[model samples]
Target: MKNTLKISAITFIFSIGVLAQEIVDETLNTQVDANIPGVVAQKEIDNLDDQAKKLYYEFKDTVSEYEGLKRYDDQLEKIVFSQEDEIRDIIRQIDSLDNVNKEILPFLKETVDSLRKFVNLDMPFLKESRIARIDDLDSIILQSNVTTAEKFRKVFEAYQLEAALVIPLKHTRIYRA
Candidate 1:
């Protein structure tokens, strides 16, 4: 009789545990069904998040570009302002013609002297031609007839021509023959 009671108790507990497990499984299944749509929606949210990150990085790049452009513009404006000031000062100096002459005459003389020396020391291919240009500049630089602007222009022209020209090699034996 005691064995029969213990076996009955064991069977009853076992049946109750099975019933509870079935109820829990049914609840879990219902919850999983309810969350199926959310799982699908989460994928779309994740895609949107990826797009937002991509746009954020692009926005960062654009902002950096804008900042670089701003810095460049600021630097350009500074250069323009500085150049305008220099131009104004130059115009003021031009108004004082004597002062301009006093300042520029020595420099022009030195430039001519240096040019003559350079021509002499340079390759002899165009020696006479370059020296003649220097001499012409010297003559005009001091001439009262030539305007100072014209004198300076001629000097600059000569210097430009000298710098821009390509002198050919001297033919020693062939020219001598």
Candidate 2:
């Protein structure tokens, strides 16, 4: 009888251990599933950051070219107005300048539009980061001088914070509740 009781007690403990493990496994699986959407959202946020960086660089190049062209235009205007022997040459040069500007104008306009979109997309990330208590938000702002990855890291951190908040709620509300 003593041996039987001891065996029974051991069996009970083993069963309880097995049950606890099963429960834990289930919880872990649920958490993983719940986190999937947040992970996907974070990826989307990263993609937006990449697009923004591309646009920012494109805009910077366009502005630099535009400034150089403006300087050239000023010089050309002076030349065109100052001399008569080269009047035909001046007119031809002006026409060439107009053609170049015309070609560049559309590209510059497109870059500006892309920059605007990037700014709009970036705002949500900034707001989320500020909400998430991320330090260096100011430093991470897309200045003309900063590296793209630094800006991306800031944006990524914001998404991580948002995911941290959202994943738990999603798990509880969808699976446990």
Candidate 3:
């Protein structure tokens, strides 16, 4: 009995489906008739509109970036122009530095030599060490690695040490007797 009922239900559903085909669209050809010249599907129109919107936004972003680049270029030009005087001043300083370096080398050499002669002729306290220091200074001045400024600084420090040695630290001598 149950099998008979199931067969009847299937037959009824099949008959209804066959009759319902006339109500629905026959094929995709009827959905877009060949006779129409410019008719397109609603889904295609929606997709085209979306693509157009995306392109429009991209173009807007590109234009904004171009304007930003234009501003940056203008600012860069201004900075270059503003720095011209400073650049010239720095260049002059550098040129003068080279001249000073040339003039000072001979003076430094003479000073070092004079100090060496004085130390040799004077009383012999730490004499060898003093001569070694002068020798080191001579090598430092001649070295390509040491800058003129650094050599000058070293010479000044040596002069300070010599001055301290010559000058007494106290005016009154300590009488511990």
Candidate 4:
């Protein structure tokens, strides 16, 4: 009976050890499965962060381009308005000219000088060839021994030519900021 009891006690301890080992293995497997989803979630979050950073930079670049276009448009507008005002003044002066007024000759020269200065300073890209042609005509008018009417006609012709060159540029669409 004593031997039988000792054998039963030993068997019970062995059974408990096997159960404990099985429980520990099951816990380890559950822990591993839980960690796999966490790792995948972290990877997805990192990818999303990278994509957001890329989009932010792209937006910034687009905004910068828009701002540059706006500035260019504003400059073009200023040039058009200034040129229009100058042309109108020239037309008014021509309409009021009398044939025998030598004083009007000096005024015409001054008007041409002002127009040339304005073009050079404000509209630098307005075809240089056209500007030169207009300048040549102005010089001829300034030095010619002609009536005020003749000078006015020549100046008016040059003014019309310059206006033709400027008008197309004015209607061009400017980009928005």
TM-score of each: 0.40, 0.44, 0.57, 0.45
Task: Predict model 4's lDDT versus the native.
Answer: 0.79
The candidate maximizing lDDT is 1
Model 1 bad stretches (over 4 Å): 1-95, 166-177
Scored by CA lDDT, what does every candidate get? 0.86, 0.67, 0.85, 0.79
Q: Which portions of model 4 show Cα errors greater than 4 Å? A: 1-4, 86-177
Candidates sorted by TM-score, best first:
3, 4, 2, 1
Error of 4 at 109 (Å): 25
Residue range 1-177, candidate 4, lDDT tens digits: 999999999899999899999999999999999999999999999999999999999999999999999999999999999999999998888666543356777777886777687577655665587568667767777564766677778777767877776788789776879
lDDT of 4 at 21: 90
| Residue 165 in model 4: lDDT | 68
For residues 1-177, what per-residue lDDT tens digits would candidate 1 score against the true structure? Answer: 999999999999999999999999999999999999999999999999999999999999999999999999999999999999999998887788878888888888888888888778876767888888898888888898888778778878877776765442343334453
Candidate 3's residue-wise lDDT over 91-156, tens digit each?
999999999999999889998998899788866768888899999989998998999989999888
Itemize residue pairs with steric clashes in candidate 1: none
Judging by TM-score against the true structure, name the best candidate.
3
Ranking by lDDT: 1, 3, 4, 2
State model 3's lDDT.
0.85
